[model samples]
Target: MQQMQVYARVITQLIASEDHTVQDLNSAISAVLRLNNINKSESPQHLKRVAHYSRLIATNCADTYSLSEEWIEHLYLFAPLHDIGKVFLPEKLLTKPGPLSPQEFERMKTHTLKGRDIIDHMIDSFGYKDHLHYTGMLRNIVTHHHETIDGKGYPYGLKGDEIPLEARIVAVADILDAMLTKRVYKEAWSMDKTLKELQKLSGSKLEPEFIGILASHKQELMNIRTASAE
Candidate 1:
């Protein structure tokens, strides 16, 4: 995901106003999400699922991971931005019904890096780069969610626990949502099949512990998905 310089300028203008207030910052983030089609009309509740499952997993594993309540809330708010880079991609590539060409796949992989730059720009526009705890967490998810536990994943190839916890957590939520939802390339998968496929990826493409945590709350996740469908 090379920088989508074209969108950067437009999005910067959209976010260029005062962001000192919490309301202003939230509005800016919403504007960026809208540009990327993460809002309700565009994504058909995909962002809702990601945000719900991210929080669901964190809440279920809070004791194990020692996650503070505030951090859990942040994951809910920020996890959906993982695919913000797709705003830069052409519509044909985003909805192509077949496997991407090697060239296309390469272009697609840059979304994570591009997403990071988007967050960086947002933080810079807010003039609060000095206070980066929240922004840093968002940037980590944007850049690292696709990364795997093994050194095989893209962009930086960060292995094992080296990837940020927030990204690792969102990776599971993102994959789960993709599996349960129909896309141009594939039909929605059954819950049983989705779980088995994810199980195969555990410890290699995903954190085994988080997968287990998600499995333990299978009913809750299904409930969330069901609600999204309605």
Candidate 2:
């Protein structure tokens, strides 16, 4: 109990401090989720994998598009929170095995806004301004990660570059992880199959440039996934 209190205090301090690093935020987020019993997998490493793969995808995109290393790092840290809104979802809805009814799907869609709200609340409560850009990027990731290149995505149908670059990178990362993982409703897709699906969706469901970056760093991303699973 004492240790948990210390952890909570440290997390609160980091969130409130202006000098907090992305690494600090990442650790704090993980600790908070664990304390809340939010992640209950055998390995419970999905968030770490998502963070690693998101950063790799972002790095590849950053290099291909001539973005800064700082921006890429910000995407790495913020991508994990894209699903933070799931915390607002009922546990039954989140862990359901069957296909969602139309009503349930509608409820599920609220996660995007819920996630954005959580982060926004955190920013307001913590009063940290030094990482404003990071916070903005995280907000984009949470709110727009569902958006597609062809304007068919949810929350908003932002097309092409209208969506934030960080969100585009996260889209690739999130889909890749979801495709590769075995969920309650579906078996894991093979890497080859997943890559082919991504290719098929390149222009319509995903940004072509980001997909190109993902293709270029396929092995590196796979390596990160493999390492995280081990």
Candidate 3:
């Protein structure tokens, strides 16, 4: 309990201090999540790729999305935290070799809500409840990234434009990386296959407008994916 208090104090000071750069804050957050056993079956580069992809998509659609540079940077930084809640999940379920049973799948779906609860605690502890673009954006990303455009997602059935834009963007970034990166359960998908699958998800599972924008930067995205593997 005393150690947790000290760690929390460090994180609060780190993020609350304007003297620290976004990169510094991002590193602090990453370190905390890693310490907690955040799981990513892909290489450590998974977060980097997702952040890069999310930034590219957000920048490309800046006009449509009304994104400012500062906001875009924050989005990139927070994008990687979307799955931070997975750390709370049982290691056995997370590393299970085969498909999960329906019960296990339901339990898995709780990660979104779990992520939100985690962020809520952090905001309360850090006293950032009033910071909309800061804590609020992160909360939205944690809770809504898995929601679908067609209202079929878990935790909440948010449909169409109802899902927060930041979450929607991270959703695309997260899915792309998950598909393209090799995991123990499956081989890495070819870029062509990944793109094809993403295209199919447009308007149903993802925002269709952003899908085209993301595809236009195929080469850059691929570069981010490969660079991480190195």
Candidate 4:
């Protein structure tokens, strides 16, 4: 524990003052996860695109939420960490070619809690001690990205403004990225189909304001998708 504390302090000292340093930190953690095969089933580009998409959405919608520039920067940096807890999940479940059974779905939901717990452990162990101003934003993104505006989402049934604005932005980014990315269970969805699905989910499963924002930005979204694929 003492050695770990020393390691944590060094990391904190090095990156504590700059938000951009968190990008390096995030990438290093992602590399570690990849080396250990924790992210083998996931695309390396998926996280990057989510970060990009979250920034795009949040940047465009900042005025609506009165979001600060710092907050949006944090959203871009930490959006990729939303699924970090999937490291604890069995790879078999992540790569399953069919829909998860009821029991499996329950296990899947636990990732939200697990993600929050993992961050809590890091903060405590690394002696970060709240000096990390954006830790709260990171935690919200990790723990609540799956939550819905209609009180049906898990980890917490938070609705409307009850959900952190950061989480809502990341949630939109995540859903859109997942739709366009191919997986064992589903083919990549076309831009038109994905937008229609987002329309279907608007206000019910996703934040209505964000859906409205994306509705007008179809061409820009296609550009993002094209860039990510290249």
Q: lDDT for every model? A: 0.76, 0.72, 0.78, 0.78
Per-residue alpha-carbon lDDT of candidate 1 for residues 1-230, written as tens digits (9 for 90 to 100): 23455455444444344333434444555666666544432263677688888898888889988999989877876775678777777777777788999999999898888778877776665465675457678789989998898978878999998999999999999998888888777889988888888999998899888788777888988899887783
Question: Across residues 1-230, which tens digit of lDDT does each residue of candidate 3 receive?
Answer: 34445444554555555566756766776676665556444234677778888999999999987889988987887787788667677777776767889999999898898777766666777676665347777789989999999999967899988899999999999999888876666777998899999999998999998889878888888788777673
Q: Is 2 or 4 the stronger prediction by TM-score?
A: 4
What is the descending lDDT order?
3, 4, 1, 2
Q: Give per-residue CA lDDT, model 2, range 54-154, as digits (tens).
A: 77776665656788877776666666667766655677787689899999999989988876766666665556546456667877988999988899888
As a whole number from 0 to 100, the lDDT of residue 143 in candidate 2 is 94
Error of 2 at 176 (Å): 0.5
Off by over 4 Å in 4: 1-26, 35-38
Q: Estimate each model's TM-score.
A: 0.84, 0.84, 0.89, 0.89
Instruction: State residue 203's C-alpha deviation in candidate 2, in Å.
Output: 0.2
> What is the Cα-based lDDT of residue 3 in candidate 4?
32
In candidate 1, what residue range of length 10 has the lowest lDDT sum? 14-23
Error of 2 at 54 (Å): 2.2
Off by over 4 Å in 1: 1-44, 131-133
Give the runs in model 3 whose Cα sits over 4 Å from its true position: 1-14, 18-26, 40-43, 131-133
